[model samples]
Target: MTINIVVGAAIIRDGRLLAAQRAEPAELAGGWEFPGGKVDSGESDEDALVRECHEELGVKVALGDRVGGDWPLSAGSVLRVWTAGLVEGEPRALEHLELRWLGRDELGTVGWLPGDLPVVEAIAAYLG
Candidate 1:
């Protein structure tokens, strides 16, 4: 089976990024990751991010830069991550067990999903 996961980094005004804790376990259980999920077939990347963000964080995003493109996870899952700004609604932990706003220095404090460490670095660079 092929698993295509599209993720997004909702960067807040304070230079912190948003991450969500997965509610299910296949891999990276209990670990934090960028807020996003699988992109439906024929769905645009940005569209997927928007939908996923609303579903997971209860917030609407004003799309920002494409910090980077998709990268393959060690689990063979592909992730499409984007950089977005908060537009409307406050971020609430909906699907996730918890949600956090993490600064670059604080990013390493969380137990991130397997492939998300690299993504953190990439996002940090993009933010700089």
Candidate 2:
């Protein structure tokens, strides 16, 4: 079976990670997640990530090291994450209900979408 791929940006600055709150798709709404979206056909993962960042957050990012291996999501998709630093523009919650920068100690303060919780933990381990 062909797996669907979703790309996420773990945009970190000043020891905090950027998280976006879902605004639609009621079931997932209000839950926090890293900013990103699904990859389009023929798009490279990195290109999709950059495009998603621009479309969702109105910002440009310089990708750093990847976070971990493919993280399983519901259905037949996987989430791939990369560390990112802002190369241009500040992030705005264009496609999200809200945006937050959570410090390492504050990671658990918000309710994360199920698929994002593990990635959040992985981020915390390195933020130390």
Off by over 4 Å in 1: 1-5, 74-76, 126-128
Q: Estimate TM-scores for all models.
A: 0.86, 0.97
**Reference-based TM-score, model 1:** 0.86
RMSD to the hidden true structure, all candidates: 2.2, 0.8
Residues forming the 10-long window of minimal summed lDDT in candidate 2: 119-128
> lDDT tens string, model 2, 6-56?
999999998899989999899999999989989999999999999999999
Q: Say which candidate scores most in TM-score.
A: 2
lDDT of 1 by residue, 87-126 (tens): 8989898888898887777878888887777788887764
- Model 2 has an lDDT value of 0.93
